[model samples]
Target: MKIINVHSASLPALLLPLIFSPALFAADEQTIIVTAAPQTLSELDTPAAVSVVDGEEMRHAAPRVNLSESLGAVPGLQVQNRQNYAQDLQLSIRGFGARSTFGVRGLRLYVDGIPATMPDGQGQTSNIDINSVESIDVLRGPFSALYGNSSGGVINVNTQTGQQPGTIEASSYYGSFGSWRYGLKASGAVGDGTQAGDVDYTVSTSRFSTHGYRDRSGAQKNLANAKLGVRIDDASKLTLLFNSVDIKADDAGGLTESEWRDNPQQSPRAEQYHTRKTIKQTQAGLRYDRQLTENDDLSMMLYAGERETTQYQSIPRAPQLNPTHAGGVIELTRHYQGIDTRWTHRGELLVPVTFTTGLDYENMSEQRKGYENFVMNGSTPEYGQKGDLRRNERNLMWNLDPYLQTQWQLTDKLSLDAGVRYSSVWFDSNDRYITPENGNDSGDANYHKWLPAGSLKYAITDAWNVYLSAGRGFETPTINELSYRSDGKSGLNFDLKPSTNDTVEIGSKTRIGNGLLSVALFQTNTDNEIVTDASSGGRTSYKNAGKTRRQGAELSLDQRFAENWRAKAAWTYLDATYRTNVCDDSNCNGNRMPGIARNMGFASLGYEPESGWYAGGDIRYLSDIMANDENTAKAPSWTVVGLNTGYKFNISKVNIDVFGRVDNLFDREYVGSVIVNESNGRYYEPAPGRNYGVGLNVGWTFE
Candidate 1:
């Protein structure tokens, strides 16, 4: 402790400007600290891998793209756009997740400290008004243990805060396929900070609509967000936020391989996946900081939020279930409601040793109301079903994570970081189903996990930094997974084991003269994986798979080649596969991991955005992928390109820029997602075919 304190005092004296000023930090320097780890973009001294997306690039790509679409630039990740506009936005991080039929299945998503994904791990980002965002920080790998639940990884979105200089911004855009959008944003300090405090606020709204390239896939969306900030003292602040979203969309169910090739933009069964959806998010938080002494201080925070959503999707009538069903009317209905709360505190324990302790509680419940007695016919399935297959679930999930980490400054070039978190969760469900095929049962479930992490970093030179670390994470079954009752299962079982994994990673970040490069290698050992089996003629059940392993490498490069030209490129290689099954017959022996691609990359080069005229396109390539867990058919690889160009203009406080994009420039045919039913009963639906779009953007700023 004495040694750590000695270096801190001396280093600040020699680095006063660099530590306090943001302009001095070069763009090539990585490891910027973020408030998610604590609110400021502080440099992380540990081996945690974090990525930041600036607001400028975000707006440029606003092609009104999904949050996941913009993330493709991040190495080792994939975001599949369903093109339906309603059920789109599927994201995968290192093959840790699969489908999101009801809601987000695995990853954790957040917006300005508020939970974006509900307590059930079904993430919601529809209210993601990127116009008011300052930046997005992503924490990947097990190092994300700091965020409870889906520690699979964390994406924390920080919105624009009020500045002393007031500003008002607005934009309107129009594109192909009957697409149109408009947005407005404003923020500023209402009161200057006096000896007592300061008051600030922000408000934003956006609305969009599209006829869509495919029939029955048209959509209309609206969103609004507001935030208020209060400074109680020099070191304390409180923020309150609210957001709401509404979407009326058409659901386009999966299509057969041949049908997709014949007409990629054609919507299948219009009555099914087509429905209206609504989501509302409310949040409030208080942050307090007090200087207990000269060298020691304390920071504490409390937050709470509520989310509600109503969603629906339709299914194809059995080929010939009945003459009425044959006409296409059967469907599926889903609803969800949730609340999240957390209290945390970080203290400078005896100076060099820092510690953080917090308790978090999340509640999520969903209701599935399916009407069985009603004839599954007519244009609207809900119109005919007379009996409701009602199911309700309640889960009490909570965890306590306390961590202590320290940097032992042994020398000017080396540092050490260590921390351990004790985490536990409890799950309980009350479920009932009235059906002739399967009986009903209600039960209780609980689980525990210990996650520890440690890292070491050595600064080889002023331009290079390297580190290594390892951590463990676990995910419990969601309510849908535990409470689901199909035609064959007796009831929800209790033998399901929580999924667990240990991830180890090594990485390096370097600034070589004029270019910046980063590379990371990672491996994960997984145990008790969750699997859903459907070998029987009429029923399916969930079980725990024995073991598996995931290993991958990621590389990224950003360079400025000329006064007006720059380029960015990223590549990912994953040798991910399941360990052959020892007890399975029929050669379930060696199979590539399901739904995972072996390689993927994106690259672009062109004039910088600052140029009066700018133009560029993205070339994205994905390697062949396995269609199922059994590793049967090898889906073909694909390459797609997109072009964008825009001219900048300014008029006083109002700024206007007109931009355009042509997606799938070559009009190639391909599918973003493919699932082969090993049972051979279901068909594979390929992704959308190439489509072109042109848009114009006009925006203004006011003071």
Candidate 2:
């Protein structure tokens, strides 16, 4: 194993001053309680890296449309809007999920304690209703491995709970490119809960539409979320959750270098194939919590969901002539469910310790079908119409995991946190459409692993602490990654293997004056790293690279200097590369991983009071990014600035807020994201130029 020297970078010149400056010291700020760790502890005491984004701050002076708008301040995390809704947001944490073409992979996601990621490690953020969110917690570094498979990072979203005073809110926003959003939310509490029958509830619904920044790229979405909690007794409680989302979007397809340079807004083949996607999903979950004894507690969660998707691709009719082709129109219907039960005990073991044990089980079954996208019209062929069935299959995946975690206070200023989980995953595929030219593709694969993690922390003083952590994690190929074979054969890629990684990290946290500052340095070594082998006409194949390494450093500071002024900054430097020669046509032994930036930075300043008026400005920076593993093409570095201003006032019992914002102030044209290893060399997805938006929110509280 080789270790990269993070101190060799120039970032220390900018970070060292903030760490040792005595002039910056002042009074301490309020303590922030976080639950990202198994034991509820203050952020300053947790031995891991965690950040919280307040829901109110995320919505303030923003369109509240996508997570990309508010999550840029988080270090070691990248969120990009492709400007194409057909493909969801591009999210990668510490270079973990950078290879994903569609949807999120290599990370765990949760909403209200229910799993948003499936048993197969595939997840989507479309169903998250930001209008009702109370806060979002992001956990990074080695500690993330405790969450089970694909635990490169963990994100949990908690929604608002009803309070005593019932309130109703209505909001609307309009932006450039004919984009608009409208939302409604309501929350309240019914009765006092010394006994049963006391209930609290919150519900939110929203609709969004966009004409898009590119030709033939338009989308519409509708989302609804509701949460209800009931107190059974002083020691038990039950909560119910429901979420639904519907989306319809047109796929503009990516552009080659020449096409992007000539006209970034043009969709070359979209008109001929009429590419598009439609999705509908609904999910419900129930959670129960009980206090069994004075020192023991139990919690259980059960959830079920159904999702249906239909997509039309741009593959030409010539490809459909092949007997083994799976056609250009794809359809999928999936049913999934999961359960998690855990017990926690707090007592004195050699020292004060909190121990938790849990079991998790999840299952998913999908019905997949494909059809030709063209039909014969006399002598000519009509495109974009379903022709004939060409492929059909049923895919099932399941996972069972048992885990244990313990936090021990070894001394007054020292602590230890450790955990272990044994994960088992199974996948099976059954072919339903069999022909003389196509053979049966029935296949199954199973994988198992034991993940372990430990952290040690020591407090140097009342206002500062340092910690070191290490862990092991693994990622299983999602059903989508296993759908196609690189050889163009008509069978599942049963030969694919799961990728495993070992990570080590050290970090420091300090309370300086009226602010908090954090620094972290980390490295990860991976075996059997997944890479894109071929991607064209919306079909992609995957292969495993021999080995890879990721080393990086992150720094973040949130400070409030004056009574009404605040400042924030975050920066990350990553050096990710292939360690072995993985030849697909060219050797890429030392090439930097594709779709990841070497350096990224963000800074913001804001001023506000209790009411009256408010204003803020922010700037974002990204270094050049590689487009593919061969290192043949790249996207240049770019920076953009934005400004927003808003006002808040009250009329009797009604409160109102209005704001406006402008992005890409200088209109610097840049690629928002890339399609790694695209077989057709159509890799660039251009971002929008200058854009403007205005929003209004009104609320009424009943006394």
Task: Candidate 1: count the clashes.
Answer: 14
Give lDDT tens digits, candidate 1, residues 160-183.
Answer: 777667877667667677877888
Report the CA-based lDDT of candidate 1 relative to the real structure: 0.57
- C-alpha lDDT of all candidate models, in order: 0.57, 0.83
Kindly list the per-residue Cα lDDT of model 2 for residues 310-397, writing each as its tens digit: 9999999988889999999999999999988777766788898766677788999999999999899997878788889998999999
Estimated TM-score for each candidate: 0.84, 0.94
Which stretches in model 1 have alpha-carbon errors above 4 Å?
1-34, 37-46, 99-102, 191-195, 271-306, 311-351, 365-368, 373-387, 390-396, 432-440, 485-487, 532-541, 582-585, 609-611, 675-686, 694-703
